[model samples]
Target: MVLLTLWLTWAAASADTTKFDVQPFKINLGSEIPRLHALVNNTRLPSKALYGVGQDKGIELDFLAELRREWLEVFDWEAQEAELNRFTQYTAEIEGLTVHFVHEKSADPDAIPLILLHGWPGSFQEFAPIIKPLTTPTENVSFTVVVPSLPGFVFSSPPPRANWTVDDTARIFNVLMTEVLGYKTYALHGTDWGSVVGYSMYGSFNTTVRAAHFVFLPFFGPTPEEIAADNITLSDVEKVAENKGNLFVSLGLAYRDEQTQKPNDIGLALYDNPVGQLAWIGSKMKLWSDPRAGTPPSVLNTTAILTSVSLYALTSSFLTSVWIYASNPNGFSTTYSQAPTDAPMLFSQFEYNIIFYPEEYVKQTTKNLVSYKVHDFGGHFPGLDNPPALIEDIREIAAVFVR
Candidate 1:
């Protein structure tokens, strides 16, 4: 019986060890440009429009119309594709699916291996600004950055099966880092859905995932009793964040709910309609970001938002991407586990994020909670909203692993 158990364990580990091919990839959007242009130009807006307070009533027609014009005229897919190609991009077959990623190695011999995970409505482009900086040797630390597109988003192929969850992504990414890339152990940093995937990896592969940093936690949030027990004190900013979080849960989660319950319905509706895709994704980009950071107030750059939308529209991945919610219907609702993780964990609390959890709340969910930080600026998309601050925070997190 003991021998059989040992044999099964060895076989499972060996299955994970199956080495796969990694091939260089480049982004090409030339053929899709004409179709994208037609879609943008043909989009019609309501002649009589009513505006509400800050995305409460959905994306304003004027804002989306302006974005549509820019998508047709100003945004250059060729230039963006060229920029993307500057970094080393590759795709590897893992579990019969193609996983696309950006692998930027540092010149510093002692640089740490770091895997960055991005969430929905986001691709590896989130880390574009920080990648070079992270790879450059700083006085404190440097990292060989590996940013992977989530399965079914952007360049990566769609999920092979219908029920692909973040947990499955976690396992495949672990294989990419350890078995494919030859990293014995690596550190992880993630935001939004990326946090869920990174958390799974941290829990499931503790020996290989040395430490982790997250801007989002799992479903286990602090209850009122736990909050009272901790005797937690909140600053005025934190109080506002809490209110915003409450508002988001009450009013702002319709998109999440739709995706979780009936992804295919909206997915099929928006699959070929770039205008629909824009309204669906662009609203979140505008509402979830820091208003002061970009042009057009609270929204991201027109080109950036268009680029993101174009990726989905061009690739026909809107359906597959939304399916993540379906696969993990209880992800945001169910507590993954109460048992603390052995890996060192760090978290960042951004004021404008959709969900806000106090440090006390985070502590209850983590075992070796090394550091908890509160940022005055930045929101859900920190990589775009506040890259410098996010980069610095990641550096601080990386220091824990190096030491």
Candidate 2:
């Protein structure tokens, strides 16, 4: 991302804001909410440009062609769509923007109230595979899950103005939980952009959020000195936040830069070439997932990788996802911007997508952090990769907060 001079800004103040007033649908017996019937029409990615992996990216010719062919043949957008709409969804207005979300309530009435937020190029749809496990852990800790589409994401509308940073979005989510759902106290978690939003809410409604759990939290808390008494080993897996990440982002972050600094321009091309889109995205999955371990397309084949990777693409969320970068270039501005948005004050190293933070440097940053939990196996998309494990982890974490 290394483009501090620029970060994705919300749609220009001057850009037209399309307003759609959606009414509520009776989703659950007593928990009905408004559903937006907004339809997007202006998208038209350049068919040819999308066919080629950016030559400048230096991808091998064969891989690029393979990427293109697979996208054209293997990826099925229609199936992805039907799979998504299968859930009960709704859209609501917040802060001059319409937000789209999928709400899944657990049968356990006493289940903890929780909300899941997604970042760029990802929609609520990504959580589908893991939904059952998380919502009804072992059919035990049931949760009324609310997964919201970040503004400009698949189902949500873009901002009418600029300056929609993590704080801005988190503020809205806070309202949604307390006002809309009437849950004054709940758990908030997120991935990528959702992580950032979760961070903001962690403080914005610190009194309410029981404890925030993020698979990709960037900010630092402890120094080895502080946690030395407890003695926790900071593994490369944990340091993946530095760049290698649990299973994604570093290699593909450059694309985030282009979106931040020149999103409109990037979008102009990506909108058309679904092939190009697949290549750009596939390249990241290649680098993040063990290339030597799995098939050429590990993300497409493995359940977790496939679920996480395919989450948004199936829904054509790329449009709204990139718009986040296009709108707030600053958030995704650093090569390491992929790092945590929450740790503004922590002296962190090898942070996000940009310049590699190196192993030792990352080791230095997370030394003393308390409440630091590390896991094995699950990559960028733990929920998709091993929902049962993630669900167990969440259940354990939530036990402290649930009354």
Best by TM-score: 1
After TM-score superposition, the amount by which residue 64's alpha carbon in candidate 2 deviates from its true location, in angstroms, is 4.5
Clash number for every model? 1, 33
Report the CA-based lDDT of candidate 1 relative to the real structure: 0.81
Candidate lDDT scores, in order, read: 0.81, 0.52
lDDT of 1 by residue, 212-282 (tens): 98888766455445556878888877776676677777788889989998998999999999999999999
User: At residue 133, what lDDT does model 2 achieve?
Assistant: 63
- Number of colliding residue pairs in model 1: 1
lDDT of 2: 0.52
Any residue pairs clashing in model 1, and if so which?
291-298
All candidates: TM-score = 0.91, 0.67
Per-residue lDDT tens digits of candidate 2, residues 277-298? 5556655544433333243222
* Deviation from truth (RMSD, Å), model 1: 6.3
